[model samples]
Target: MWVLTSQFSRNLTSHSSLLSYLPDVKVGKTTDTGKFWDPHFDIHFCYKPNMKWSVLFVLGVLSWGNTLATMVPKEATFYQLDCPKEGTLQYFMLKRSGQAMMVDNTYKVMEQNITIHSNGSIIFHSLKVEFEGTHLCVMNHPDNSIHGHEVKLRVRPLPPTDLWGAVYESMFVTGLIAALVIAFIFALGCFVYKKQWRPRPEDEKPVMSGYENPAMNPSDDGESGSTNM
Candidate 1:
């Protein structure tokens, strides 16, 4: 059970191949392109090596049908495999479930061999069990006719999410949210502690107006004073 994934550029005008060897067993197989193939991203799975059972599935599509054939690039051609040296192939299986599926399936693949044959085909061991999915299978000598080149395989599964996206919903608000909250609180406190119209004796005293009071006239003041004496 071995699964291998690869990626390439769409603009090269000619198809290309690569060969790399991975000695580590973690995070799955990774093949970096010695050559850069830009503007094109492709994904496929290789299921079951050397066995009659092999299949390739195109990813990121909603449904599989005739309509998909039309979507495939006319300029793009199928990729072949290549190996550096001759060696016995080793394999492993990995099971993965995604947002598109109800459960995960075990995928089988091998780490890069110290020595593998040129133009070899590889496959995922368990992909056949999952008829509802798409994957890639390796070729016996995909690159023999093509010659020495570097190929990159992208096989690691990404994190999945439910209805809500990964980072779209934010509890964090900036600028206006903080400003409005502070303003509302300040206004509310101001109203509660506001000053009233209550006045002291000085506050009640009247300033000069146009009319004069007859009680305080000079003649009236004199008459009052004479009577008092």
Candidate 2:
């Protein structure tokens, strides 16, 4: 039995296809001396090279998918101001979980025009270009834990008031270019027609009556000759 098991092991490793035709073998009941009464052989199993690589490839794909799912971007708060006049005051609430928190003094204030209150409210006085950027609000909780939040700011200029200015603002560059191309083609067509098809002074001729010239009165001279004859 030991020799048979060794032979199976060697055959399994050398030719993995042996597993397909291998059958289950059960040894006979053991006797008092711990020896089997019947002859049986044990089968050994081994993995093929292609099967091993396929398992590794599947594991790699699963790991990569999990990494991508974890790397998704988080959304942040944003604020926009439309043509805010100078010296105008603006307010924003940075409250979280319905609790009022105080700002951490360790964080430096980058914008002089902005102020943070103990109630998680941010205020911008005399809003200017310097105030239009990212602001960080760091706070200390009751448990002495520190937390930070980011706020984005944007400023836009006033809209145009006149008709042409409004139309220009509403139209994109491609639309403007197309309009100019059409006008240029119309102007070119008008120029070509005037230069090539319009009548010239040298090509014009005067219209004369046939009876006013001697060469055109041949019938009258023939009539007088007949009368003389």
Query: Which number leads on TM-score?
Result: 2
C-alpha TM-score for every candidate: 0.19, 0.25
lDDT of 1 at 47: 48
lDDT of 1 by residue, 28-145 (tens): 3333632222223333334445443333344324346656654432211222233233332222112222221111232222331122222344322222222222322222243443
Show model 1 residue runs off by greater than 4 Å.
Answer: 1-172, 193-197, 200-227
lDDT of 2 by residue, 1-229 (tens): 1222334436564665654544444555565644444445533223234666789999999999988754432222222222222222222323222223233221223333334445555544434443445554554556665555555654443334596877776687769889999999999999998789666778888667775774445465466423343
Q: Which stretches of candidate 2 lie above 4 Å from their native place?
A: 1-112, 126-135, 151-157, 161-164, 168-176, 183-229
Alpha-carbon shift of residue 98 in model 1 (angstroms): 18
Per-residue lDDT, model 1, residue 117, is 24
